[model samples]
Target chain A: MLNYIAVSTIPIMIFIIIIVGVKEKKDVYNLFIEGAIDGLKIVYKIFPYVLGITVAIGLLRNTNALNIILTPVIPLLNKLGVPMDIIPLMALRPLSGAASTSLVMDIFKNSGPDSISGKMASVIMGGTETTLYTITILFAAAKTKSLRGTLIAGLLADSVAIITAIILINIGII
Target chain B: MSKIWSCIILISIIIAFLTGNPNAVTSSVMSESKIAVENIITLTGMMCFWSGLFKIFENTSLLEKLSNKINKLVLRFFDKNELTKEAEKNMSLNITSNILGIGNAATVNGIKAIEAMAKVNKSDKPSNNMTKFVLINTASLQLIPTSMIALRTLYGSSNPTNILIPVWIVTIVALVVGLVSISILNKIIK
Candidate 1:
């Protein structure tokens, strides 16, 4: 039953959305096409950002620098029972969504999606936002020069989310 | 962004040369663009599909209805005089789309909300309500986390949705922490 709901969720959502569109007398097909085009435009806009982060990450990973950098922090993480594999994800997540997505894919590839590291990475990804990205864009829109405590609060929340993910996975609660 | 990008590349190149593997850096620089494009291609399909569906939702009264319901809850977060009705409406729409996990739509509404709030404020600095709203958005509590689930399925997870409950728990924890801290900071910072 749970699996059924899990798989059917999107389809059910689509159904309700369609019903709502129809009742509202919307040009649903045309609107969807327009929105899809907007989606394409969004992807296009983010492509350069994605490419930049991807190459940066690739260089970091391919050069073994990622390991070198993490060496110092690994012992502390190990003491907390945190898996070493997810360290990159934790570090990159708040900075860039594209970078972290790539890292999550890497985690899925290396550890398998059902593994503890993969589950924790998934939970962390799902739970948190790209804090820096969102803040930059929102503040730019608002034209606010002084962010005050927004950045700190957002990062703190991200930390809490990551810790919660680790604890939940470690306790076998998920 | 520029500083962080340069720092990462600079450090990576330095480490690569020191470790005597300049070839690895060169090859990664050459090949990663192709990998990035491939990842974008994979993401594009999902983005278009969900954005298309969300657009349909936007055309209907459903989004407005949902936003109206959320507005009641969101209003309590702000002082009654701090937000105009227009800002409150946009805030509700932003929060509604965010909770629904339609991120692109959420971003559009979020920008609108912030812009609305900006017009009402007298200073260049962010107002308390603006700070609170941005923090809530940055914490980004989603009920479904649709994109993550899709990525998990694409990776052939044996049980992709198993992480759903855990994500919800974590999201709530993050949001509560965000709200509490922002409130505390609002008092101390000013």
Candidate 2:
């Protein structure tokens, strides 16, 4: 039942939006084309960032450097009941969406999408924003010199989301 | 970002050589770009479709109506008269689009909101309201999480939306913590 609702959510949303657009007598086709072009531009802008982060992460993973780096912390993570596989996702969630998404895909491939670690990764991905990127881009628009409390608060929120996700998964609350 | 990126790549390459796996580095460096391009291609379709749909929302009164509903809830975060009418509208639209999981649209509105707030700001520094707004954005109270769902489906999740409720719970927790912390920090920092 829950799965049914989840799958239908997007389709339902699109239907409603289309219905509303038609009711408003708007030229939905032209607007969609314009917005798609804007979307293409956005993707173009972020491609370099995505490429850079993806390759860096790929190197870290393929060279076994990530495991090596996490070796010392593995026991601590285990003690906390956090799976070692999700360490990269947790670390990268705040830094880069593209990196974290790639990490989640890796988790899905390695553990299968229904595994505990994969579920946790999915929740974390959905729960948190790319804090550093959003902060930089948003502040640049306003020309804010000092981040002051924003950065700290943003990270604190991310930490809370990560912790909450792990706990919820462990407790089988989800 | 540059610093972190360079450090990760450099450290990975160094470790590869030290670990006697320079070949692994070579293979990954060649393959990762292809993987990155593939990921972008996969993402482009979803992004374009959602952006187009959201554009329809924006062109009609749909987004405005939804944002108006969100504005009432958003008002509590700001001081009385702290926001200009334009700032309030853009912020509401930003938050609304964000909740709807149209991230590209949300970003456009978010930047507009910041610009509106900047006009009303007294000092060169960001105001408490501005920080609070950005904090809300960073909290990212998304309702749908479209990209994650799409990726899960692509990866062959038997139940792609299985994590949806948990994601919602976590997002709410994050937003509450973010707002509370920002409120406390605003008093302390200034």
Candidate 3:
């Protein structure tokens, strides 16, 4: 997908060159280079943070810290009527999907794909995203550190999703 | 950072467990690298695919057309309609992405819109208008829920679209509650 985006931008660059020729009456080549350079500049600024987060995710997974966090949250989630198997997704939602997918696979294998627990977890997986990924990319793009209620709002949204899923499933609403 | 807090909690629990407090690691938490990987691929693919689709829509002018239509509603919420033509187009793309249940994509578009908005703003910090934009993005409107539907299909559900109604209800409720709180918060902070 990343490769596709990089490839797709080429035509857009060509269109700019055409516009420069037809309307701007300026140097088309220079405009193309400037455009590419601007993109490269943005990429350079963003790469380091992306690398750091990726590594942090890797370390957390390797150390089994994700499970460690999910442990306590599970019982409370279950008591709240959340499907126990879906707890890992909540923990994974702050990191990367690479980590979340692995948890999903585990839930599927253990609980069987048809089980309510497995199904609910899968549904939650589809409906939500990792909070960190959304925050990091959006905030970094805007060059802002202050979250300004985004985190709380995102968690609340996911909580609603989970609760709704459980309630509906238990009632056989879905 | 939440990460640091999580690490501390993990270490404390592990130490407690090693000291014969095995209850520290509840039976509920279990790590499976394989399951996590599958979820990552599927969800990320869905997000990227939707984001890419939105970009395509922008290139096709569908986004701009929609933006013009939504301009009235946006004007009411934002209290401004002074955006340049291009800015309106960008804002439309961002808003549409949120309405489509693609938060990741919406954020990408939101960043672009913010930059455009900031360029036009006279304020040092984010403007009231900018705050309203962020509030709307954070409280995003979702309809299809492509990711959730994809997950349902993946798990072998007989009717994946069955989730649509429930998703719509909760999303509407969320958007309403989120908007109200942000409006209240906006007044308090001001």
TM-score of each: 0.91, 0.92, 0.62
**lDDT for every model?**
0.86, 0.86, 0.55
Superposed by TM-score, candidate 1 places the C-alpha of residue A84 at a distance from the truth, in angstroms, of: 3.3
State how far residue B118 of model 2 sits from its true place (Å): 2.8
Worst 10 residues of 2 chain A by lDDT: A101-110
Runs in model 2 deviating more than 4 A are: none
Query: All models, DockQ values?
Result: 0.70, 0.70, 0.12
State the weakest 10-residue window (summed lDDT) of model 3 chain A: A46-55
TM-score leader: 2
Give a tens-digit lDDT track for model 1, residues A37-131: 98899888878877887788788888998889889988898789798778768888999887788778667766788888999999999999999
Model 2 lDDT tens row, B58-153: 778877789998798988878747788889889999999888877767899999999999998888889988999899999868899877887777
Candidate 3 per-residue lDDT over residues B1-190, each given as its tens digit: 4575366445645655555655434432233233343444444544444344433333443444566787667667664654655556567777876664445446666788777776776645455566556656544266555555555556665655555555555556555655666566566554
Off by over 4 Å in 1: A1-4
For lDDT, candidate 2 versus 3, the one ahead is 2
Q: Order of all candidates by lDDT, from best down to worst?
A: 1, 2, 3
